[model samples]
Structure formats: structure tokens, C-alpha cells
Target: MKFKNHILVGVLLMVNVFVFAQYGKQKKADILFNKFSFVKAANEYRELIENNYNKDYATRRLADCYAYLRDPRNAARYYKKAVEQVNVPIEYYYSYAQALRGIKDYKNSRIWLERFKDSGGVINANDFEKDVNFITSVFNAKQQYFLDKVRFNSKFSDFGAFEQNGKIYFASSRDEGVSVKRLYGWNEQPFLDVYVADVGTKRNVDHTAKLKGDVNSIYHDGPVTITKDGNTMYFSRNNIDEHGLSKDKKGISNMKIYRATLRDSIWTDIEDLSINHSEYSTQHPALNKDDSKLYFSSDWPGGFGGSDIYVVDIKADGTLGVPTNLGNVVNTKKSEGFPFINNEGTLFFSSDGHPGLGLLDIFGTIQGENDEFVDVINLGIPINSNKDDFSFSMNPNGITGYFASNRTGGRGDDDIYAYHRVPTLQVEGIVSDAINTKPIANSIITLFNDKEEQIAYMVTDENGFYQINIDRNQDYKIVGSQIKYIDDYRTFTSKYLQTELTTITANLLLNPVQDVIKLAELNTIYFDYDKHNIRKDAALELDKIVSLMQNDYPDMVIRIESHTDSRGELSYNDKLSIDRANSTYEYLISKGINPSRITEHEGFGERRLTNGCEDGAKCEEKDHQLNRRTQFIVVKME
Candidate 1:
């Protein structure tokens, strides 16, 4: 009996030691997993499972590690083993359901999801409803129709898409018959060129050719963006000079960023971007939806690892500020790149080290103040695959996503694919005047989504045309107004509509009002040098005048009087002032004001004076411009 007892005690001690060792390994794996060191964590978990200690716990954790690594095939297999064990935790059911979802087994996923709900778990029903809604939408006929219509034929790897002014700009590596292939490090495909496609017909892209001129060079140039006016382009290019040229005579070395101007519908000379350099690679530029800020990926010094996301302010003059790291919340000690920030402040990025579905998967988080990021979530399954997936772009509405993926069925090493958020509705329309059958220009239109929040605002163009984009799942109240015109409000709700382009026209008729007529309250108007031509600033102010006249005194007729300083010859200055007043008069008439409602103009040359100025006065040019002005005086209150 004593001999047996000794042997048993020795066996217990060995078992305890083995268990402790396994526990330490599991703890280490958990730590790395939390920090988004997914590859390392997966390896650690795999070692624990191989040791065969606490098989249930080790298998479960290993499955989670594989999920983070974006290896759903392995993740699902191990998760199956974990769920087969007796008395599994409720959280394990949720995990298994996610694995099933990642593998596109929605029916089985629903089974596990329902089991989780029945196990006295307090799940957020709204989130489950959203997932279900999205899945149902994806399985719908319309989604399949769109998928069938869009072809994936390409000659090179393409990505980093952006849409502006009904045109799509993206990066590609296709050969343009250039002799030497651009090379970056060991990667032979360093030649990235920017290409543009017009969405003129809405159904297809007009890829008639690459963007006009030096836009497509022999260097790696991509991730292009344009301001709201479409005059200036901000793009990333690699190579030679501080002006974005290849230093090598061959024009195919190094990488940097540059800016170019668009004149006469063609890209002119290019200037090097002042913010980046060859010492550290900076690529994948994304402008904020408002074009107020710029985000990009950089492998510069002081970063967490291989690369990280950085941002800079876009000055009004188109200059970029000093780049600032996005901090640890959005970045890790591993590779973090391909960042995209939407209009709603939601950030999407691709990371190799984060807990995801595969080698590199896309992730999303909400940006917080003080350069913080929170609520990190993995974009699972179809959106993220087991292969390298990066370079994603989304429409302002966030309903559509375009990304580059090397997944099984593609045209080349990488191809562009577009995915639409399931169950989305669209809000679109045109803005016009009430009285005349004419479009309005410079009219501000605001759209408020179902959450009673402003989602988008657009101005009517010279043709009085505007389109407001909205998510399909919600209701919206749209309001359109212009200064001097009555505000027009309308409400509409959308259902399941899969049309590529939905057209909704909301015409507004603003009746003229006759109440308050306050003049002299206007600020001084500005004019061009040596001419009475109305400047843009002057037109903006005159818009206010039109608004007041239409809304406050619709039937009132007015006389526009032009004035000039005492410097110029009397007749010349008088004629200049008269022309200036007539210019304002013509603009109002073009904007739908009745000609009879505006009386004739008078040029009070040097007669009217706020400041006594004889010939050769030492007044500033600003003051003199102010003296050469136009005024609208009420002629008759109809």
C-alpha cells in the first residue's frame, strides 16, 4: 500500500506541472491576440493544441486564433471540434456561429445564432437583425444580377478606387508599352499608374483610354484625388525629383507623392509632394469625404512596424501639413496600411497582424478625438478572404465597397470587385425653381436621414441639378433652399430597390413675399481691379439680395445704381459703374427674377461720397474698389 501511494503522488505532480505549462502558453497567446499580433498568436495556440493538454480549451482558443488570421477553413474545423465537447460555454456558440458565417454557411450560422439566443444570452437583437437583413439582401436576385453584369477582365492588378464628378480613378500595373518595368525593392511590379473611367451612362465605365497626358508616367503613380472643383489633383508617385520625377535616367526608381493641376481638361506639369520622401515610403492616399483631410499609409521612422496609417490636414491652398501617426488604437506593431475614412468618420483599413480572417484582412473602427480609435471590428467573410486583400474604397453612402483581392477567381494576381451593403435604399433627386421650368444654380440642398441627422448636402450646379445619396435602409427628410427663396421641404422613404441609378425629381415653387425691405444693411461689394466686373464674392452677396427681394418683397420693383470714386475721368468712371450695375441686373434676371421687377440703373459717377476724395487722393485700393460699387434701391412695392 505504501509503494502504490508513492507512485500515485509522483504521477499527480507531473500532471500538475504539465497543466501549468500549458496554461502559461495559452495566456501568452491571448496577450498577443489582444494586441493584434495574430500570426504569432496563431502559432502559439497551435503549439498548445499539439501538446494535448486541456484539449477542449486549447482547441477553442486555437480556432479563435485561426479566425483572427483570416484562415476560416481551419477556423471552422477547429471550432467544430470545440462545439462537440460537452457543456461548452455560450460564448463558444457565438464564435462557432461567426465561423460558420465566415464560410458562407448562413443556414448553419442561423442555427448556432438561435441556440445562443435560447441559452439565456443577452444578445443585441438589433445587431443580429442587421446581419440577417444584410444576408437576405445578398441572397436576393438583384444582387446576383449586379454581380453577373460587372465583368472582372483586367491586364494588371488594380485597386484604390475613388469616384468624383461621375468619374472613377484607380491604380493599376498594366504595361503602357514602356520598355523598362518600374521596380520597388524585390517587387518587380512597382509600376503603378493612375487611370480614369467615366460613369457617363451609369451602367458601364467608359475606359476609352487612360487619363490625358503625363498623368500616366513610367513610374509608380496611383491613389489620385481631386478637389471639389476638380482643378487640382493629389496623387502618390514614386521616383526622381522633389517634383515627382524618377532620379534615375531610366525614370523608374524610388517612390514619393506629387500634386498636379488640371487645365483645359488635361493634366499639366506635376509638382513633387513636400510631405513624403524616398527614405520612407508613403503610399495609399485617401482624402476625407469632405476633402478637408488626407490619410495615407507610411513606413517612416517612429512607426509601430512594417507600415502604419498617418494623416495630415489639407490646407485651403492645397498644401499638406506635417504627417501625424494615427496612434496605437488604429495601428499596431505590425503592418497596418490601406486606410480609408468615410464621410461618417468611420475608418476602414487593412492589417496583416490584426485578429482577422486571413493573411491580410480589412478592419474597421470609429475615430475618436485626440487621435484615438475604438470599437475595432473585423469585416468578415466575402469582404475579407484567406488571401491578401487590401485597397478598399466606398461611396459616400457607404452602401457600396470596391476592393482589390487575389481571391480564387480573378483576372490576374489581383482584380477589382465591388460589393454593395445588403438591403440598402437610395435617395436621389433634382432641384429646380418653382415658377419657371428652369434649373437653379448654387442652391443648397440638405438631406436628413431617418436618424434625424444630416447625411449629405450638395449645391445645384449652373444647370440647377443636384443629387443626394442616402442609405437605402432608412427614411429621409430633404430640404432645399437658396438665399432670397423660400425653403422647400419634402419627406420620402425607400424600400428594396436595386436600380443602379434611381431618379427622383423634387421641384420647388417659392412664392414671393412682401414684408420687410431693409437696405444699407449690406456690406460693401468687391470688384475686379480697374474694372466694374463683379467678383465671385460680389455675386455671393448679391444672392442674398435676391433672396430678400423674393421672400420679403416679391412684387417690389427695384432700381440698381452704380457709383464710382472721383479718381477716373467722369464719363469713363460713370460708364464703368453703369456696366457694373447692369451686370448685377442681368444676373438677377437670369436667376428667374422678372425684368419688370427691376428698374433702370443710374451711374452717380463721383457725386455720392462717404469720404471726400478729390483727384490724386491717397486712399487704399480696397477703399477705392469699395467706392466703385452698385446698390439696389426699391422702386415700387407691387
Candidate 2:
């Protein structure tokens, strides 16, 4: 995500176009827009729109303003009007899709996405359809994080939160000195500086205060990384030295990473890293857990993209070795940088080149079994957006982490967000035979979702203990069945607790079946969405159950109970459910199970819901599907 601020001479050219031809609010707004003062530009454009002046330009500028500001809902609204009035840019379709995604209008996002691709879009549309499918699953497949805005965030660009020992360090561009104001050419805001805060007695951090003296420099200072011992540091700064600001051939000052040592709590002896050069840029340094290697982003020559992550070995004598690119798998033809590696050797970074839900999505890669890094996966939605998200960091505890985003609903242009992963619900206990009260080894423990569809399967350990992961505020059923024992069923719904993680112990004791093992706690039959026809997979399961009953318990009786979820009218559901039950009975008779032996079959309709997902109660498909099911019971003994 690009910040709406002046960064280069190109922006002055954009400003000149607006200044030369236009006047009044439109031109004034354009001036701010060229300078990347989106907040002010949005205000001016909104004023013109309210007064019904320059409708086309006003609407377009407003849309651009909100889009740059990461307010997608507003961007989508204005873009709609702009498109209706004048020609909509092809990139607007991509922006529209991102806005729709941010507000969760995924289906519409797809529609606009197709329009984007059809409008001659290229360079970043690879794997578009595949990513859309993956996104849908991610939206409903249980979120890994719950996020909240951090406390010390200024109304400016505040990000890069890192912690060590009892001190939390970060970078912020809050106001420094108005008397001798200095603004970054790119964003026109105060330059960044590394700040320190004390780790709180209860919370992770307390209050933020800027670094003193040498640590705070005349130029853009920080976004720092420190060694484990905390006496050494690496930070980003402008291209400058004793002779003054260093410039490349184009007269553009580049960024460089500097190393400093902590002497008596003061940072001194600052020197440029060996990788720094006046010819190209290198910044954003991260040290490994053992400090054996230093990784940083560079836009040097021979790189695959404008910027790529490179690593250099930290020699035993505390000097840097030659730099090496992270390779093509992690880098792309487009920019990829801001890398942070956790203790597990997983590399997390932000990139726009990879096909994603939106701009600069955060991605993670783990050390492959046979490779250095592989399995790069997008950290979809909430954690990422169409906006830029970078400078990712994770604490030592692993349950919580921090990152920076320019996405909507933040306190600044770029704000830091604190995220916590939901702890897994572990279902673990012993399984045993009911009559013998002895551990049943190798029993099958199948975990089913609210829809009574199996999601995971496990075998009992030597102690007959079975364990599986589950979720809170959700329904799950666990079934245990040994080779000779009748399957026993236990259903539970986990709840929120004080601790971050929770466990449920369910000791399942299966009943022995000598002659006829009546179908108990087993509901394998399934139907299409609201249809009564049995599917091939359902038939496969039913065929096995029928074959077992006909061969072993020819004289036994069986019962079929069919049910439907609480949707549509009650009368319609009742008829549909009864038809499902009759369909099951007919299918069983087709398999040669005597109709006389199966004397019981009925439809429950929606009279009894497994949960309170009845009509008028808001629910998702999974919750409502829980009520639609089939179960079996023994009616007569052999």
C-alpha cells in the first residue's frame, strides 16, 4: 500500500498538471492529492461534491482519497458514482474488488474482479481464480487471530513494534520540532525515530518515549533490531556520512543500515554496514535467534525485484560477510521485502507480486524438509487487506504478535495492531470397553462437525487415549468404535474460559456386540443441499452398514430417524424430512435388509434442534446444517 505523500520528483510533475489547468477547490484538492496529503485532499473533494461542483473530478478525487487512506467502503461508494458519471479507470475495478473484500461482499468482489481481468489488466492477476476460492475457505475456516489496535499508536504512521528483555521498542513519526521542522520527501511527515517503552507489570507495554541523544539523529533514524544481549543494534538511516548526504548517480539519496553499540546505556560508535552503498538502498534489518545471520531488504543490482530480502553471515569476529539474495522462491519479479523470521525458522514478509486478496499481503514460509524455505502461504483477511501490511514481528511467546498496516479503521496513516491467536480446544481422554472396563487399543475415534460430517479421525494410543483439536462455541460429536465393540457417541460444545487454551476430557466406553451390533450413535447417510436423493458417498457408507447387518443380524430390527434443519416453512421441512426417511428405507430394502426387520422409521422435522438455530435466529450454514441429519437405533434384539 502506497502512502499518500510526496516521495519523489514525479509527484511534482503530477502536481504541475493539476496546477496549470485547474483552479478553485478541484485544483486545491489536486495539489494536496499530488503531495499525498490524502486526509486534506479528501476534505476538499468532499466539499466540492457537497456543493455540486466539478462532480466528476470531485467524485474521482474523493474515491482516490479514501482509497489511499485505506477506507474501502467510502472508496467503493465514490467509485460507483465516478464510474456512473465518467469513464472508470481499469485499476478502479481492482480497488473496487479490494473494497468489497474489506467489507465482506465477496460475491460482488468476484464480479468486479472479473471485470478487472477483462479490462486488459495484467502483471498481478496470476492465480486470481485460485486465490478467490482459497479466500472463501479462509473466511469461514475459523480465524487464527483476533486483533486490537495498540495503545501507543500516534495519529501518524506508527509501526514496527519489537520487544526485548523488559523494554518494548518501535518506530513512530510523531511530531518532533515545529521550530525546525523536517519532513520526509516521500510522505511529508516528520522523519521516523526509534522509541522505547517499559514493559508493563501486567500488560505487554506501558508508554512510549523517544530515544535520547545519538540514537535520535538528524535524518530518518530508526526501525531498529537489537541483539539478544541488547548491547548491539542495527537501524535504518539516510545515505550520509562525514562528507554529507550520499547520493547515487541520479542524485537520489538512498537508505542504509547502520550498526551501533550500547555503551553505558548510550548508543555510540555508529558505522555503516558493509552492504550499504551510495549506489543502491538497503534497510529493515532483522537478526536471527542465534545472531548467526543478519537479514535485511535491499534494492541493489542483480535483484529480481525493486527490493528483495538478502542475508549476510555474521562472522565470529562480529563483521558482515557478502550478501546473498533469499532466492526466487521467496523473491519475485515485483518487490518483496520487510522479512521477519521466528524461532521456528518461518519467514514472514509482505509482497504485492504474489497473487493475493489485495495489495502487499503478508505471507509466511517455513524451512522445508529438503529446502531452505518453502510453502509460502498468504495470511489472508483481517491480518492482511488490499492495503499494505508489513514490518511483521512476533514475540517469544508465539501466541501474540504485532504488525503495521495502512488499512481502514486505524488511528494513523500506518498504525500498529496487536494480534492474538485463538488457542486450540484439545479433546483428550481414554477409551475403554464398557463391559470389561479395559482399555480398548486401536479403536477408531472420529470427530464430526455440527453437520455430523467427519472432519478428523484418530486411533487410540496404548492407553486407549484419543485426542483431537476442536473449537469453542461450536458443536462436535466424537464416536469411538473398536473392531468388536459397539460405537459410543459423545457430543460437546466448548466454551470461552479465562485461560488462552482449554481441554475437554471425554472418556468413551464402548459396549460389546456379540451377535447383533445395533447401529448406535452412527449417522453416516447424507443428502444434497435440501434434496432427498442419496449421493454416491452416502451410498458407499450405507452399503457397508447394510452388508454388515444383513450378514450378521438377519433376524434383528433396525430404525431410521431422519431430520431437517430449521429453515423454510415447518410444513415444507416436515414433508422433505419424511421423504428423506422413506428414501433411506427404500435404499436399505434394495440392499436386501428385510423390511419386516426394520419396523421403525420417522422424520423429526425441526421440532428438536441440536442447538438453538431455529427459525428467526441468525446462523451460518454450518450451524443450521447441524439439524439436518440421520441416526439409527436398535428396536428388536436378535
Candidate 3:
């Protein structure tokens, strides 16, 4: 009995020691996670979960670690286990939904999202569902962008690409060949520094160097923007002073924006912006088209998300106005940053809150009527993957640009990708007067779809040129109109567009409404040898006249003349011609054309034969058919 008791006590002591060791490890993992050291925390938590120590807590923490690392596969795996527990937090349901979305399992994502809603989640359930469906359809649509990884990407994180003055500026953590290497605990990479490289015509980079200035610091730096004049610049860096970084109560050093001036071809006069707060972050500076405003991302208090985009006006004396939040439209309930405003005033930024393919997708928005950014659209596909994609920058031309992504098949944790969008399918043309061929300035050009719904419109420039982007494989109608000239329309389809031919030119010529009558370019109205009643072919031709007079020239009046082939008797032919003219006029009236537009109807009975098929001349059926015709001549314009 004594020997058995001693063995049991020994077993208990060993189990206690194991439990204490697990407790210590769990504490360490928690500390690392709280400090944002997700890479190391993920390793620690994985071991704990594998050993079945504190399985519930460790599983959820592991899932969170993967989420923070932007690893959706592993995150979904552990989150699946975590939420299976009986008393899991409701927020985990929302997290699982987002993780499922990252893996493109949108059907299951919607299920969990609905569950999250039923469990009292604060998100808009309907909007998220609609966004999922909309984004899925867009992803299934034709791809419009092509991306290539730049050669200068380092083995470490290399991202946040910008371009100015023939050089590409980016942030990187590459420190090869340096005497001493400082590693960040978050991912064990070197501290980020601003780097620049000459950009080739094809966006290729063969060499890179640290930016030439005192702008780089031992801490995180870079992701910059320059003014149009190239004499001023703004960049982001960790909040620091001579005594080292300024930290909040939690010992986290947030980022701050700094302004620098160019002198002697190097950036100097580094000054931190007054808008930064020690308790929050303000980084990722961007300049508007005219340099009158500055945009950036921050985690400032009262923000709708972890980070929200804000804008500030630049006064004439180079001072900044009060910062204003971009509002809930552009800012979501999750992080939104890395703003880049193109010359056309379109705002492009990265967001994780919006329904997307994965972690952080690039979105574009245009200013709405209320001056708020609206119509946010995910860039979709090749620009975004199932990983973190951000820091989008595009030129004013809206085709070529660069973005950063940490997706698979990259050389580093994050890589800069050069992207070129396929040219937008567009139609362009000149509008001119029909008589003198002079360019018609300020003429309205309207575009309609197959449904006859107006989709877009623009006015001709001083050069009488107008261009409009259109969709592929769709039928469209373009109409040119001026006050003094009759409107002209051309219908065309974009079906089977040539791969190399992107632009469709459709010039329009408008006729002036003068004292004399004018004839519209219509297919000839035809009749049978002895028949005068309207035929299917004749009805089709008459519809054109009806449309031109009723829709294009509303106040115009017309006269109709009809004829019959010489094969018929002259008396019968004359009666038949009159019937043909009367039938044409009646069809127009039936189709809603004003009767006043047809002032007279007369029959000529083959008197005006168009060819030598007259009398006894031997001619083919097609030759004689030409003489059986009707003509619509505009009589008066008011």
C-alpha cells in the first residue's frame, strides 16, 4: 500500500510541473500576440494547441494570430475549431465569416455572416450579402488588368511604391551587406527604409538605392508623395525625437507624417506635421492633383475604423487646414489606408472592410454630388489576391500603375507589382456641319444602350472631338445634336471587337435646318411590280423616315413621291403609285409621326426611271425593281 501511494504522488507532481510549463508558455504567447508579434505568437500558439493545453483559448488565439498575419487558410482552420466551443464569443462568428471570404468560400461566408447578424453583430447584413454577390459577379467578369512582379523586389518586405520624376520610390526592409542589422520583432525583418530606383519604360528596375537624404531613420520610414512642383514632399515615419521614439501609454510608437523641402536636389528641412498625435497613427501621405490638399490614413480618436482616411487643405502660406474625416462612405468599420488620388479626382485606397477577394483589396471611388466619395468598387482579380494587397498608385492616364501585395508566388513577404490595365473600350468621333464640313463645337453627344436608355453623354470640345468609354459586346447608339442642326445618330455594336483595335471612330454630320427642303439618308422604299400597298421591305424603309422626322427633326415637314415599274399598265401603274404614296404616309402616321410633316403625296408612274430598264429595254429583275420606288423629301422646316 505504501509503495503504491508514493508512485501516485510522483505522477501527480510530474503532471503539475507540465501544467506550470504550459501556463508559462501560454502567458508568453499572449504577450507576443498583444505586442503585434504575430509571426512568433502564431508558432507558440500552434504548439500549445497541438499539445491540447488550454485548447479552447489557444485555438482562438492561434486563429487570431493567423488573421493578423493575413493567413486566411490557417485562420479559418483554427477559427473553425474555436467557434465549435459551446461558449465562444459572438465576434468569432464574424471573424470566421471574413476568413471564409478571404478563401473565396463566399457561399459559406454568407452563411456565417448571417449567423453573425442573428447573434447581434453590428454590421449591415443586407449590404454585405449584396456586396458578396456583386463582387462575385465582377470577379467572374472579364479581367482587365495584367500584373508583373518587379525584379528589384527584395527577399524582405518591399512595398508602398510611388513614382515621380522618372524614379520609383518604395519602402523596403532589405539590409544585405550592411555592417549591422536591426530587426523588427513583428516579423524579424529589418526596419523599413525609403528606397528609389530608376524606372524603365516597361516599369522594369535593375538596381535600387536608399533615398539620398536624411529622410531615412533607424525606425520605420517611407511611403512618400511629392508635390507637382517637385520641390516639396511628404512622408511617413515612426513618431520620434532626439531621445528616440515617442510612445503612448501602451509603449506603441505610432506613425506620423513629416514634410520635407528639396534643396540642392536632396530632401531636407524635415518637419513633423502638427496633426499627429502620440496616442494614434497618421501616415501614408498623398497629395491631390493641384497640391491643394493632403490625404492620409490615421487611427485618430472618433474614427469609424481602426484606421480611416482624412484630408486637409493646404493654405497659400503652406500651412495645413483642420483635418476632416472622409466620413463613413469612404471610411469603413475596418482599416482603410494608402490613399492615392489620380488627376481625375478619383480616390483609390486599400480596404479590408469592404467585400473583396481577400485580406486587403484596392478600391476606387469618385466624388458624389454631395462631395462625398461614393460608388466604391473593388479593383478585382489580378490586382488583388488571397492576401494583403495595398499601396496602390496610378498615373493620371489611369492605365499603368503599381501596387503591393503579400500574396503567394512572391519573392518576399510583400512585393511591388507593376500593373497595366487593358485600354478601356471607347468610341470617339468628330461632329461637323453637313454642308460646309466645319467642326461643330459644343454639340451634345449622347450614348444609349440596346434598351435605348441613356448611359453617358458628353459635349464636343472646341476641336469638335468627343470620346466615351463603352462596354464590350454590347450594342450602342450615339447621337450628336446641336441647337441649329438636325440631330444625327449612328448605331453600332461592340461585338467581336478586334483584339488590337480598341477605339471605334463614328463621325457625325448634322444638317442645318434652312429654308430649302432636305432629304434624309434613308433606304429606298420599294414595291412589287403591280402592287402599291406597303410591303414588309417598304415598311422598314418608312420607319426610318418616321424616326427622322418625329425624333430628330420634330418641326420638319415632308412630301412623298411614289412610282411603279414599266412592266405594269400606265393607268394601273399611276393608280398603284398613288396607293403606294398614300400607304407610306398612312404608315408614318400610324407610327406616331405628325401628319402635318407630310404636306403632299404624289405618284409619278415610272416617269422618273432610275435606269435604262425603261419601255422595251431588256433588264434583270433587280434592274427593273429600282424603278419601283418611293422618295421622302423634306418640304419645310419650322
Which stretches in model 2 have alpha-carbon errors above 4 Å? 1-142, 176-179, 199-208, 432-438, 442-463, 473-638
- Superposition-based RMSD of candidate 1 using all C-alpha atoms, in angstroms: 27.7
Q: Can you give the TM-score per candidate against the true fold?
A: 0.45, 0.53, 0.51
Q: What lDDT score belongs to each candidate, Candidate 1 first?
A: 0.66, 0.72, 0.78
> What are the RMSDs of all candidates, in order?
27.7, 24.9, 25.9
Off by over 4 Å in 1: 1-149, 176-190, 200-208, 242-253, 368-371, 424-496, 499-638
- The TM-score ranking, best first, is 2, 3, 1
Q: How many residue pairs collide in each prediction?
A: 18, 4, 0
State, as a TM-score between 0 and 1, how close model 3 is to the true structure.
Answer: 0.51
Most accurate candidate by TM-score: 2
Best by lDDT: 3
Displacement of residue 562 (Cα, Å) in model 1 is 65
List, residue by residue over 304-403, the lDDT tens digit for candidate 2.
Answer: 9888989999999988899999998789889887888775455788888886777787887633324365335677767888799988887765557788
Over 4 Å off in model 3, which ranges? Answer: 1-141, 201-208, 426-638
